[model samples]
Target: MRSPVLGAAALFAVVVLSLATASHGALQYGFYKGKCGTKDVETIIQGVVRQRFFSDTKIVAALLRMQFHDCFVRGCDASILLDGPSTEKTALPNFSVFGYDLIDRAKAAVEAACPGVVSCADIIIAATRDAVALAGGLKYQVQLGRRDGMISQASLVNLPAPTITVPQSIQTFRAKGLSTSDMVLLLGGHTVGITRCSVIKDRLYNFRGTGKPDPTLNPNFLQLLRSFACPKIGGDNNMVFLDDPSSSLKVDNSFYKQLLQNKGVLQIDQALALDPATKPIVQQLAANPTQFLTQFNQAMVKLGAVQVLTGTQGQIRKNCRRTN
Candidate 1:
């Protein structure tokens, strides 16, 4: 009864529809099986962090702090952002309009795209990585389908290593199941940001005193540092590099190279360079920027794998900055 041409066209349409359905189904199943979990988490977190933080240096600094603390204890748990004792208490405000705004935006987008599918914890983790990418860091695909976490423990909030001693920092990371290689890689996040005097005053003044200072710092840079951070007054900390200024924003091995030259900012940054075990990896990362980017992407994927609540477990908060 049907014409041959019409029949063929109908068959083609059916085939196309079938393929699309199959693809969508595969994506859904893959997500449930934890295929794209890392990528989804990183994208969400990075997007939110970028939207929330106004200052690039502050955003990068907070991200580095988050990575250091998260990977230091159990994994990248987004716990470092919480306020409590045992935390570093960096100059960045915990609950700011900037922070919450971006988070809320991310949540809203995710909810619209895949309602009640992804978790806040996953979102936070993904958003941070995305922020790094936005800042010219390397890009890698991550997985998705993580759920939100209902439990927000006070203990988890205050678990960052406040002081920056090499031994203590190493101990902190080791406790978190991170190796020295991971520590060096994670610390590379300092490539793009500034440190406040309040955060490292003790390191600059108490650790080295006025005259000697950290021998790694450039003398001219040190003079600028004293003017900006040393007076103990509240002001912007001078920009420190994980890499050369030209490629500082890029997530690469230059950070390790900087460390090799004693150009690291914090004690933790310098210690990685001197440690024989970590020095090789640092040099490797410096030499092969692509390798560092690959590692960074993989680490981000791992970081996004923390506990998450999904599939009707947690409500989509209208405001990510505040608990609903």
Candidate 2:
């Protein structure tokens, strides 16, 4: 355990993708260092995340997923936090996204110390980074200075589907200026989360309309899912861990290991291990859990910098749910 943990911590040093990590023009490692006067804004956010995590262990996954969904659409902005009849929060892909109240809580705490100083966009990134550390993930320095976006429309949401192919996922992430390696590392976030049974039943019962389980699914794993996690009918919304049950709650390479075993609950998860283009990366990460743990931090850092609004491009919202 000690060796593996140390390895993951060193994973960040192994990556040299300067292009993906160049980040936005105005973003910096500690962009908010002196902005809050006497208070450390990130420290404030971390405290909120720690408290919520103690009460809701599942908040780990929710916040992690929140980062992906929020960043993927509209470029790491708090656009996903905007509230309206037609905001991105109302989008179909974001229907299951949680950790909203957690962000709100963190934003409120920061606002109390420095009114209208911290952007909700930065809060989302900071809070999610804190949650990842609390959930056994390597804590990475999240770039700050991201301003909250003024627009968030459901029509603007185009999150990739659960059934997306490995190639398609690579393209999708590439469109956002992320690399294939980044795609593999980012998808690896699923190592700590669970998917609703409704999201994976198609692979279990009628894969490709063949009226049979997906051929790649491990027989034992398939039986386990059908028995209790997901059934042929009903139980559409039941929770099922994305990784093996024993280690689903941990942030490690278990998800990639499970992929090697044909136990991936989602098509995309299994596809990484089986796809020609991504299999090597998956094999490397799976064989070296530490790499998955460590590089994941760098991948997330790159994620936080995606097409972000900086300087005077956006406003600092007093309330994350609306434009200020």
TM-score of each: 0.67, 0.93
The regions of model 1 sitting more than 4 angstroms off are 1-98, 153-155, 158-162, 208-212, 215-221, 227-246, 306-324
Q: In model 1, how many backbone clashes occur? A: 33
Give the candidate number with the greatest TM-score: 2
- Pairs of residues clashing in candidate 2: 8-290
* Candidate 1 accuracy as TM-score: 0.67
Tens digits of per-residue lDDT for model 2 on 206-250? 999999889999999999999988878799989999988888777
Model 1 residue 316 lDDT score? 42
